[model samples]
Target: MSQVSEKAVSFEPEEKKEKKEWKINVFAMLLVLLVIAAVITHILPAGKYEQIEKNGYTTVDPNSFKWIASTPLGFFDTVKSIPTGMVEAANIIFFILIIGGFFGVLKASGTVEALVSTMAKKLANREKLMIPIIMLFFALGGSLMGMAEEALVYVPLFIPLALAVGFDTITGTAMVLVGASVGFTTAIMNPFTVGLAQGIAGLPMYSGMGFRLVLFVVIYVIAVTFVYRHAMKVKRDPASGIYGKFDTNEQDSLLTAKVELTKRHKWILTAFLINYIILVFGVIKYEWYIKEIAALFIILTIIIAILGKISLDDTVESFTQGSASLIGGALIIGVSRAILVVLNQGHIIDPLLYQVSEEMKHVSPFLSVVGMYNFQVAIHFILASGSGHAMLTMPIMAPLADLLDITRQTAVLSFSFADGIGNIIFPTGGTLMAGLAIAGISWTRWARWILPLILIEYSIGLIAVIIAHLIGYGPS
Candidate 1:
């Protein structure tokens, strides 16, 4: 009877078994986008813009756009762009890997756990305060300096912190992503976006500071409120969280246990703070970029490993494990860059920009400015780099603003609003995708959760542009 039952089970149809739910892979999605971008190249007319070097900035001549021979990517070329994109984005990829390795060393050293545990205990009663405090800090970083990709390093730290505090990963992720985004969008003194755009538009650097400051306060309030409400809701009802259960089974003991910051942990924390101080100083004073920042982190990683009293082999192992955790995010960055590669190789970016700019010319000044704002948002998907987008579009938009009787300052504002806001939600944005990957959140899930915020910010952007036009926002 047992042999007969076994034979029956072995012959059971596979279709009778429960099927696993299919989840979309980010890499597969990027591959599909690569194919779609190639198809777009075939459909759209190719064109080129004559770029001129002015004040060490290469900007396109608005009137110099002309149709060019099409150069759409073939199948092999589409596949080849992946490695090319990886090569193009090598600095960013390596930066992310180094950050992972750094954090890995930090976490392995018990510094992160000790810090999170201390914070959790200290703020157990006032845990809600964390959202505003952390968000505001990151927002200031973004507004003061273009702090986008740099914010990713905080994701792993924030995730566990949020989890420890009875909040979800989304809440933690928002503290960095949305906070920095709000500040970046406002662009009070953000050199990468506002500074570059204004220089190209012939406005003094950060000229419209007063108005941007107003926007910053207003948007920061909205962002904090949004994140705070969500955090509280999750706290009150764990099931209300987006990620369902906050699974910390592995660390449940650590989270619930009393953790004190020891002398070594304090030293590690001080080292981190000093490193950040130097990083900011270098960025502002010397304009340090990827290569410099990566090297700094490598040094910090070594110092951290030594301070933690971790053996060399263990330190190396921790670094490797940490870097390995972020490999998915690093690849996402490469794939995101590939989309731009395909579009740039096809020479359609200029044509698309020309078409949109020409379309705006036929509208009223108010509507025209609004169109320009929307155009910046649309173009951001392909041209994700703030400085690159500014250089490519500002020269054209600045003159177009003049032709349409709008101020160049408003054009710059529109560009900043679009570029900054789009960074958090856009799948094509390498930083956003990389951050999402690190947080273990799918792009679709993030989009749904962030949709309302995006809508509110978009509305704010529209109003800001309209007000800029009505009141003549200019470099005074």
Candidate 2:
């Protein structure tokens, strides 16, 4: 099965506009939320501060001046974050190379294409509910593939199918986001997010797969429900128009991305799989870190390029092109990090966290963490990207969980839910951008359809965590 034919992705114009409009709305909401948060923090009553200090919370020294003293340090703070930026740049480049190799091998061997085509044939007749089916397909894909980028190959095929079935482009784009987030947030298999979070929190790798799988199903159902409701609404009221005018010329076109892979592409895929298998074993036995895994990827890229009989120049060209495709996303990530640094430098993260943490302390020790967990959930709405927010805030949060007599696992789970839910509204997310662009949907349209669903699911997730705490699933 050829990869392209196996999956029917539609890159139609209507979906793209819906995504654009949704993004615009999300950006506006995020800005307003940030401003309101800032104003509230600025006007915090001194009595609350006194009560907070009485509760043993670490008080931010108003006269200590780290926040105000470094007013001009914002420029250099970005410079300092350059190392992180470089690391991110490298990660993006390597990810593209790895993805290209995997796709190339699958396409050349006809495995991916065959699978997609076979699946499509079975699904074509069920096309009336195509959005939900595609959402399920990508959710499974994300779990099995263990990589969100894998969706990039098939989103194009799904968009057109969506349009053909009388749904607009926004519905198509939303499907991809729903699937990716469900799989990503609750993935029992993906080593990227789950692995990093566990490793950092000093938990055993893959120890919590069962717990995560449960989350996966819940998130999937929530995502599907939200998407279905919005799609139905759009169908019922076309004049209520849940989309913006799509810019059909958005650069993430699948047509331009397709390239022919030679026979050796099969060997490269084999090599890639074998390499990862070895990596899994190595991590299990030797406690390898990300840098080690990265080294393995670099070595495999070089070896596969040679075995495929591709010239170094051609290999480099392909790799460069792949890297270039990700540059836009990479830049956005860096800028977002810069904004984070600004927020942190302003001493805002801790103060707000302290406020929430203090409130949680008054509750039962076992359930006190729920409030803090919910706080993260709220923060997720503003900082919708996952790793970006997690890496920035979890370190501070993990310790607070311990101090508050909360289970770290519970804290991690809450972070996961928040991180996952945040993506539903954040317009700056790469997956959302790519999915919308391909479908020709605008951000405003997407927000109109998906925001309510995001809120509902987030609410449900909080309830679930609360239930988990009540049932003695958490530590006191």
Candidate 3:
């Protein structure tokens, strides 16, 4: 799902703003691990477990672990794994590509810009509700559709609105960044995170949704409340805003420009809304996965391009350029998969799961659950792609959850919580980086303002994990 995000993302900042530069390159760090894992294969004992596939997801047979001859990966194999992992991760990689392409077509049509303009006009005076309302919209989008990179497109759009509302660039950025994060961290039906994790964990699609929906509301409240307080403070004192390199003269011109929605824009937006309705229906009723979801976007892309009367060449170019933008995210998915590739090829995955299961047995189930959450947070910091993270971890975590006397649902919850919360907070997260870049905000500055909210979001995840355990969350 990720290579596409890296490729399809194309944001033109209003102007280059000089600001503090922070360097913690996640890609270089993640790729280096491929070699590290290959080296570890020579030291970690080789073992295997029988795996059975059910409904298109793989589950390891916990009873079938057996020691195997070591097959350590040489340096050459580690280098070769880049392409191999991408090919293995094609399902999600392509899904992200098509989604990126689709959004490219949509953005090129100027509907998103038009919508942002409309929102700014209506919300100019209702500044107090902007945080709660705007953030709530983004939070709902995240829980419902696993929105992350999609939120980046709105970052530039919101900056002017924030300034117009007498707030800062950070406030505007937070509306798009943290707004979606609340629902993401407390996922309800996010196909990318909870859905993929749960499916691999061998639980029903969207099971235990009742508790998740509740968690979604609570987390959304916290997120909006946090952002609201900051927004209002900035509104009261323009000097209080963290504009970084943000210049009032340059940004003010953007807000002052007229953005009247035309009849064509109305038709285009209607088509977009209908497409989402179809998307939700297909996912819920037809049990659509990556291929189906990607196909839906392809169809919508065609419809939008035609209605917008964009030339075939322009449409293809836009789609291609957008798809190209997300290539990094897509490649990262494959490269990250290479780490698991080394572990799996060396037959050490089962032993690792076994060791983790043994460790959990020494602790309370609650502690085990928290450990799962924390481990996922650590993993998500490195592997930002939700589906890629799921493919890497769920095989081991599912059976480990079974062994720990905890429901797979709880394990999925932990994965969802960890996976979602880290996206905005971590420097490695492509979406977070992209959003900060688009808003012209520094990571250090964004972290200072959002760290407290991150802790609160983490607590919500912890509470949800604990509640899932106490409720014995599963039909499996």
> Residues 434-469, candidate 3, lDDT per residue (tens digit)?
566556555566787889988888887887788888
- Highest TM-score: give the candidate number: 1
Q: Each model's C-alpha lDDT?
A: 0.83, 0.53, 0.72
TM, every model: 0.93, 0.60, 0.77
Q: Which of 1 and 2 is the better model by TM-score?
A: 1
Per-residue CA lDDT of candidate 2, range 1-476, in tens? Answer: 32333232322234232222214433344344434444443454322112113122223332222222222234445455434533544544344334444333333344333333333345544745676677887776555334454455455445433443434456666687678777766656555554555555556665556666777777787778777776666556654433333222211122333434445655665776798677657665675544566576667767766776667676676555544434443444443333344354445655565566657756786567567667777776445455545554455556666777666666667777776666656653545544554444555656656778777767766776675555534322
Better of 2 and 3 by lDDT: 3
Better of 2 and 3 by TM-score: 3
How close to the true structure is residue 81 of candidate 2, measured as C-alpha lDDT? 46
Q: Compare candidates 1 and 2 on lDDT and give the better one.
A: 1
**Shift of residue 170 alpha carbon in model 3, Å:** 6.1
Cα RMSD to native, each candidate?
Answer: 7.3, 8.3, 5.5
Best-first order by lDDT? 1, 3, 2
Model 3 ranges with Cα > 4 A deviation: 1-16, 91-110, 141-181, 188-211, 233-247, 316-334, 364-369, 379-412, 422-451, 463-476
**Residue pairs whose backbone atoms clash in candidate 1:** none
lDDT of 1 at 379: 89
Best by lDDT: 1
